[model samples]
Target: MTKIIMRLQFSKTCAFSIVAFLFLFSVKAQDKPEIKIGGALRFNYNLSSWKDGQKKRGGDFGYDMFRVNAKGAYKGIQLNAEYRYYSEGFGGGMLKQGWLGYNFNERDQIQVGLTQVPFGIQQYNSHNWFFNLTYYVGLEDDHDMGIKYMHTSNRFEYQLAFFKNAEELGFGNNSEVSPNRYSYDVAGRNKEINQFNGKFVYKFGKKSASRLGVSLQYGGLYNLDTEEVGNHSAVAAHYELNKGKWNVKAQFITAAHNPENADSEDRAVVTMAAYGAPYQVAADFNMYSLGISRNIPVKLGPVSNLQFYNDFAYMEKKAAGFTDSYMNVTGVLVSAGNVYTYFDYAAGYNHSWLGGNFVDDFAKGNPNAVWEARFNINIGYYF
Candidate 1:
């Protein structure tokens, strides 16, 4: 009887301790950080004249992608990340971007990890669904593992960054270079390393809404075959103007890459890869792009607005006898509650990703290559 009484007392003590711990934890939870999650589900429909089989079968519609976004903040610390999943024919799955950041003040912050490279226009150089030629050449919307410092205000904004290298997929220094990625990178016999970037923008007009910017980038190309380091550099100037519901964007870039490949390898072209695929691109080129977009308020059942856009880009190769490349896309974006859709009519000539033979369209494309057109529609629901 005495032993049973002692056991009951012990149980009561344990229960009291647990209740006290829970109370303390609930009080402390109010001070903890908060995280938010968001994502999107997307699908695509395409009809290309170049695809004889698809054209004969009334074109094809299939899954496009699904992505997740995460963001969190507490005090001066911030976090951002996104991951995407695609079909096997694409790059399967990859991290679009992720970064940890600290804000020193309202206008100054620093980001570390895989971050977007500040080049040409701010976020995008094109308005259509398909980006400009700069994207295919690894200039627009490029990201690398780096550290970046940014300062922003109404009058001017500037950013400086240094990337040790592109994102790695395998372990160790001798691992094979994989092409399964979202952004184009040097993958064949070379890798990009020790890259530096600087971008400055001046704001003026219409309550400081318009912007003019210049961007500079320099990097080393490490050749695995020759064990030598080559050099690459690019300079770009961009301008953006906003008037009422209309927006205009223009940019010009000159880039050159000198890769130290083995004696047997071709030096005129460098192999670039993304989306689980590899292709050759010219080593030196000059490119320019222009885009215009206008937003119109409309009421079409669940749809609330419409944005019409036209984007065009041209690439002129520096190598003698190399054919030039160009792309043009005209599209409209429809916004309806949590759903958005894009209808695009895209055409290209001697350009990769449009109907050109994936081999050398961006290197020394067929001089007689003709224009090819494709119609595409993409729909996405976001939350």
Candidate 2:
């Protein structure tokens, strides 16, 4: 009996030692440096119409897009990559984004790759869907192959970028001038642009806060003979006011120089307003609007809240002209531009998930889906 008991005790001790060794190994593994990867997928349908002679209408529905992004970080070095696939009838088939980054302390970093241009408030507010309306006239798309430097501290953040002129990539190419034979414009030939942008935000009072920002960009295009023919410049300003549940936002943007015809120039200005609290009708995400918004809560499967909004605006396009000769003949040509007035009404629903929630319902639904046949609608989703 004593011999058997001694063997049992020895086996039990060995089992405990093995289990403890595995637990410690796992803890050490968890402490090691590693890289993480994740991304999202989206699909959409869009329908849009414009007045050429009469009201022309067109629409498309398909697998709008699918995108995957991966990021790896170790110590102060970071790398990111993104790939996108779009269905038929879209501009391009495959799009890609890649970047390498380094951090200098905690408040500053430099990244080089295809990235977003840091401009208007709408450009960086990843959570706000209404920002789509504040379009800057001359800035490139959200994604461009470029290098950017970012700095952020307690109360301020700023970014600057240098980008490859997208026109050279056969992306934003101007085919009108070279319809029969291929000819490159000065801007398309050089294929480079310099951009500067910054923002200053301050928190004050008990419940109120404010922010202001400015941005500028300049680029030049050269022809085969290295002659500068097309030049472009843009500037913008943004301001925001918030107190309690009421908020106000405004922006102004101007651009000069034409991408299509190197010799031509185009310019525009935009302003917007928003008020109320989240989910509240008065606070429903609305733009350049004057109206009321209210939020109605409901118990449902996916969507838990609804917002109703109505807005009206009268807008006029600005006259175009060159900085050197604001009153030149070209400036007079700007007067021929068209002005537009719009009246808009919208109702939106927001959804919350009980468990894992990653997808944005608004972005998944058909942007042109009509609530009522009486009026047309253009909707967007954000994530």
Candidate 3:
């Protein structure tokens, strides 16, 4: 059912888009649409010592995904789109982002169609490929189908958005439908996701290098009626610093959800913006993260730059039964022109419900809960 729904959405809404992209190069060569073409390829070597549903250690080395980006603007109208090819599911295909924008001025703009949500710590600061726990909870690197209006000033920036599809679920890109992944899906239970989000940021320090922001989110878990049922609300605060060689970031957030109508399992349903089947975890949770990084000026062969980052993230379920989780990641990223590589070592306690081990829970009398570790490396190049 999920695949069918996504197939319908693709055929109905994006058929023309796919065709246009296939001929994008020819169109650009003949007539200048002010088009820019670029793409990226990413692959990873990952080893998971332990996680939920996994009985033993496992690892894999393979391509993660490939993406192409195109952007152009004419007058006040702008067009941006991304097409992606994944390694798994639905013949390894999907759209990552596509949007149209109208800029009223340098500081005021309106965006229509799928775009990044302006909430929490935008884009995340983790040096690792996977962001943080908030990402799994739909607070980081989350996007939606919606209309967004934004305004920016020297000291302040704000955005208002209304989204209908929560993270474009069930689109057959296995990642969005997999219950074990960090995305969300409606599971054919809800008619659509209706959400309103607002974010405000204020900068105070010189060069606006120091910044703080607050965000509010409200999502309606609509079942059948236009009068929505089920309610989810979240609030978040974040601080960031960017000066010299140091880059620091921190965030705190919490959310509560009450599915107006209970699921068959009597679980509360809340998406928050996640659009995979696994994203529907019913509980209030608090999350906080701090990441700090410093760059080292050095040239290693073609690797002309080096950056080291230490990141920590924590998530605790407000409900009584769920296990709390945390993780600390340390890595150094090397940049060689348009290519980048990350060698990361992550250690944590129950980092996530799906991504953690049960060492702490299994130890009956032992007090020191052993921490699990995963080592990974990812190399990517942009063209």
Task: Give residue 121's error in model 1 in angstroms.
Answer: 0.5
| Residue pairs that clash (backbone atoms under 3 angstroms), model 3 | 183-276, 184-275, 184-276, 185-275, 185-276, 230-260
Candidate 2 TM-score, C-alpha based: 0.53
lDDT of 2 by residue, 1-383 (tens): 78569747855764565445334433322234556665444443333222232224454434544556677765545678766555444333444557767666579877766666666554432112121222211232344555677887656777876654332244434321111111111222233343344444443445436666776767543333333334556566666555543445455555444333223322121111111101101101112312223345555554454444332221112232211100000000000012111112222222101011112211122223332211222222222
Q: Which candidate should be chosen as best, given TM-score against the real structure?
A: 1
lDDT of each: 0.87, 0.38, 0.67
- Which stretches of candidate 1 lie above 4 Å from their native place? 1-30
Q: Write the per-residue lDDT of candidate 3 for residues 176-291, one digit (tens) a residue.
A: 23332223334334433567899999998879998899999887665542334666678999999999999999988887765554434334334322222223443577788999
Worst 10 residues of 1 by lDDT: 21-30
Order of models, best TM-score first: 1, 3, 2
Minimal lDDT window, size 10, model 2: 325-334
**C-alpha TM-scores of all predictions:** 0.91, 0.53, 0.78
Global CA lDDT computed for model 1: 0.87
The regions of model 2 sitting more than 4 angstroms off are: 1-33, 45-61, 94-96, 122-141, 167-192, 195-208, 223-226, 241-248, 258-299, 304-383
